[model samples]
Target chain A: MAKIELRGVVKRFGENTVCDGIDLDVSEGEMVCLIGSSGAGKSTLLRCINLLEPIEDGAIFLDGQDISVPGLDPQAVRARIGMVFQSFNLFPHKSALENALLAPRRVRGQSRADILPEVEALFARFGLADRMHNYPDQLSGGQQQRVAIVRALAMRPEVMLFDEITSALDPQLVGEVLDVLLTLKSEGITMVMATHEMGFAREAADKVCFLKDGRIIEEGPAAKLFDHPQHAETQAFLARALK
Target chain B: MPHQQTAGPTRRQIFEARQRRKSLVIASASTITVVVALIVLVPLAPGWSKVQQSFFNGAVLAKSFPKLLDAFMINVMIFAWSAPAIAVLGLLIALARDAKSPALFPLRIFGAAFTDIFRGVPVILTVYLIGFGIPGLGLPRPWNSPYIWGSLALVLTYSAYVAEIFRSGIDSVHKSQRAAALSLGLSERQVMQDVVLPQAVRNVVPAQMNMLIALQKDVSLLSFIGPVEIFRQAGVFKSLMANFTPYVGAAIIFLIVTIPATRYADYLMARQMRERS
Candidate 1:
């Protein structure tokens, strides 16, 4: 069974449907990238899997159990699947270290003493050791996004979601954040991300799903998907996206 | 000027400095004129001396000063006790207003009703209603004491204003922040206590400081229900001495407290704005 599975998931905002009968799978340690134009429901799809947006019709399953049932606690499911946002969303009032330490201590019921050394090590591993003492406002865009990633990792979640994490960074700063993702992939975390970085998606994604208007137009292994056009919509999106 | 060896004071700088001096002289002259006119013209009024004697009697002021200070301490005590209650209750009300759960709809309703009723009705009327109405129930001992009931009134009314201020502060926090916290698996309560309130409260400190200044003055409204704070004490002195100077003294005392607080609040506001920008 896939590690995270969505079966005909549907999401709507008022009159507009953002996720139209979506189906996807992320097996253990697989990196699946969702690539699409802006407002193509890529972010909303990721948000739904994280239970940030309640789906109108569909079941989300984790480890063969339906996780999207309305009464199931989102917090319990969320603790197992971490998500990073387009905006770093680091608490401005807290130091990077505190931001990383907060969720594990509060949600996972770990004492700060037990969580600190490991979280500090995660910061160091991400090349954020010196910057961890600074608040989010004090950090550069790349550094803040890295801290946000570390904050998600601190929960030690089984599955991780990235919602256009590098899209907010400057062009020059984008590489560092993408590099962090490569490291996470190599370390074998089950990861799914909605991304605008076509180069990174082509190079690093195990699976690439091309989405348009809330539906996946085409999906396959990253190499095949990028090297050959399987669908007209995918071909058109890639032409403009690559150009 | 362009060929000068040293850039010692450009011509424009010299002109600007001279203009600055000219404006300063004019400002000083105008201020002095206003001051001299007030000094000269005030006593020239037909009833000026009698008006001054009634409102500004130095003897009455001196006699009432110590006692007024004593009564003002009551105001301070009421303020000190009520301020904490207002803050805690106001925060709870704010959180209630922010309730997102369908089951918590009543709490949201209660929060909305509370702020509307207390903020809409005149504060003095609320004071009279609570201060007199509650005690009129004839509760035994301290419960019926106006000190207790009167401060309760202030807490209720000020808490409504404070709750609205707090709600604004909470609203100022971006929705994304809450999403970020919740995405971390934090329970709603944890998200609020840990993530949202800290930023919200910090954002509104200057506004709350203004509330504090208002509260300090409004504590004297308790005097109507018979707490004998500064306002009531002044009334006693006015009746006894048949002079209004005590009222003038009371105003001075209030200015002494509030003006410094007002300045400090402005300082905090400026520093916060600078930091945010």
Candidate 2:
């Protein structure tokens, strides 16, 4: 497991600053849920931790190692930290099993024979055994997202970052993907997720952080935050988002 | 299933069948009228017989056929050699154009310059320059051979067009796909090899097929530098016989090769569209 720490992480696109001097910590095996309105910078923070976006100011530490230094190889850091996107960007050219198998075979240098059984077990355990051979186009949105999760997990990542992984899924399909996350949490994988599912965050997240205007407005245990939000902004946001 | 098949032609189906037959009848009548009119009207023209004698003489065509076919082998030979070179060079140039690293950015400029020069120049001009220009040096027999220089010219110019087609194919893959690949712990090179290139090549097949047929036809343009290919041989036959029939025979040979290729390209494009939709 990995502990992720962000110290004054700032991200900008042109003149707009999306993540302004944000500080956050995710302990090992902890599930931290970032809740926010659109443009509140929750997703940007997650991307910063994954090193997908370059940080303008501040450092991200993966297991106490500062990974944000310029010229350092991003691949080494990325290999240990897996991310899933809201769009479920499964490669359209490959089958679900191949998508899960590609990274381990290439990056980790695991032979197909060495990795196949475990990867197959992942699919079977996630209830996707029959869909493994089907192409991404042939699968439903939820099945593809599960395969995306499986693809990430196949690498045996110490930390998993989920950037609104269920946002594009149908409402009926969202529960299946969320169930996979709960299972992962139970298995002791550290995770940070940007989500709009307040109920899931309240039920499953170890901590709930409410973000607004690129800053964390309030953060506490899920029950505490849901029951008695400290900030007026957090309360107002919750009133609108929880509806 | 058997019951559904047996109950197949409903009243609406019968009406649709009658409509189809009516349209077919109308289309056939109009097509036949257009064909008969062209056949009758062309023959009635005063100069038609002389035109036919010069352009379509059976004796001249028969005599030219054997020599033309033999000469045509040179064009086929040039195309065969140049195509693999173009495919390899084209992909390299396309990859060069897509270079993202700071150190490799110069290759992007080089790729752009390459495509600009080769695509901007007319095919014949490029063929002439490389074919005649290089041979004009006091090079030895093999180096001065038009066959070598001529094929080189085709490779350079067609590589430009093929590279652009490949670049467009690369652009069509969504950015999210790249992000997903990168996030999966694959390095940039691995992502391109595993994720990007396979899809790009498949996406560009129909367009690339059209380019191949074009390359096949343009191989004859090398004759200007004097390899005595089909087009040049046809000229030889025309002068020897004092009739244009040999040129007509050459056109028939070219059509025989290219028409099937064009139809195949169309079939590939249609199938791709169906699959995508």
Candidate 3:
């Protein structure tokens, strides 16, 4: 069974359908990238899978259990599927270490003493150990974005969602954040990201799905999709994107 | 030899130096003109001596100082007790006003109404109503004490204003911060307590301090309800001495207490602005 399954997921904002009848599957340990122009509902689809945006219709399944059944606790679903945003929304008041420790300590009911070693390891692994005590404002945009990713990882989520996480970063700094995703992929963590980074998606993604106007136009293995997009819309999008 | 380098002011440097010197001259000229005007106008005014004697008599000021200080202690005590109470009350009301749950609609309305009524009514009237009206009920000893009632009245009125300030601060936090917190599996209440409130409190520190300074001055209104605070004591001395010096003395004491607080608030505001930029 796929790690996550979205069947006929439809998300609407009033008259606008942001994710219309989306169907997709992310296999365990696979890295899937969603590529599309702005307002094509890439972000909304990822959010719906995490239950951050409730789908108006259809079901989302995690490891064979349907999670999109209106009454299921979204907080519980969110804990299982962590998300990092485009704008590195690190808590400005908290130090980087504290931001990483917050969810594990509070939601997981782990003591600071119990979680410290693990959190420290994450920071050290991410090359942020030296800057752990620095507040969000003290860090550069790339460093802050890395900390945000570390914060999501601290939840020990089954699947991670990245919503244009590097879009707000400077061109030079985007590499460092993309490098963290590569490291995560090597660890065999499942990831689904919405991105405008065509090169990174082509190089790193196991599969790439092209979306346009709230629908998936084409999807294939990353190499196949990037090398020869089957659909006209995907071809046009890549033409504009690669340009 | 290299081309001769003249170390004295270059042409551009000379022009800049001339501009600086001209600004200095203008500054000093303005300062001296203001001082000369004050010097020439003050002693030439009518009733100057009578005004001085009645308002600035050294002997009367000295005699009134100790008594006024003692009375001012009451104002300090009221402020000390009520400021924290007002803060807690205001925060609760602000949270209620900002609550999104359907069940909390009534509480939201109540919070809105409380702020509306208290902010619209003159604080003096609230003091009069609570301070005297509560005593008129012939309640227990604690309820009848003017200190208790006066402080209660002050807290009630000020919490309304402070709650609005807090609400604005809470609203100013970017929506993305809330999304980030919620996406981390924090419940709504935890999101507010851990994420939203801390940022809101930090954002409004200067505004809150300004309210505190205003609260410090508003304690004087308690004098109208017979609490014998600084202003009331000053009034009594004015009646007894048939001179206005006691009132002036009270004004000076207020300035002595509030000016430092005002300056500290200004400094904090400046620091906050600098940090944001």
Sort all candidates by DockQ, best to worst.
Answer: 3, 1, 2
Which is the leading candidate under TM-score?
Answer: 3
Query: Cα lDDT for residue B66, model 1?
Result: 99
Give residue B87's error in model 3 in angstroms: 0.7
Residue pairs clashing, model 1: none
In model 1 chain B, the worst 10-residue window by lDDT is B1-10
Q: Which residue pairs clash in candidate 2?
A: none
lDDT of 1 by residue, A1-243 (tens): 999999999999999999899899889999999999998999999899889999999899999899999978999989989999999999999999999999999998899999889999999999999998998988999999999999999999999999999888999999999999999999999999999999999999999999888998889999999989799889888999899
RMSD in angstroms between candidate 3 and the native structure over all alpha carbons: 2.1
Q: Model 2 in CAPRI terms: which quality?
A: medium
Every model: iRMSD: 0.5, 0.7, 0.7
lDDT per residue for candidate 1 within B1-277, as digits (tens), equals: 4775556888889999999999999999999999999999999999999999999999999999999999999989999999999999999999899899999999999999999999998889989999999989979997889998888888989899999999999889898999999999999999889999999999999999999999999888888888889999999999999999999999999999999999999999999999879
**Cα displacement (Å) at residue B276, model 1:** 3.8
The candidate maximizing DockQ is: 3
Candidates' DockQ values?
0.80, 0.74, 0.82
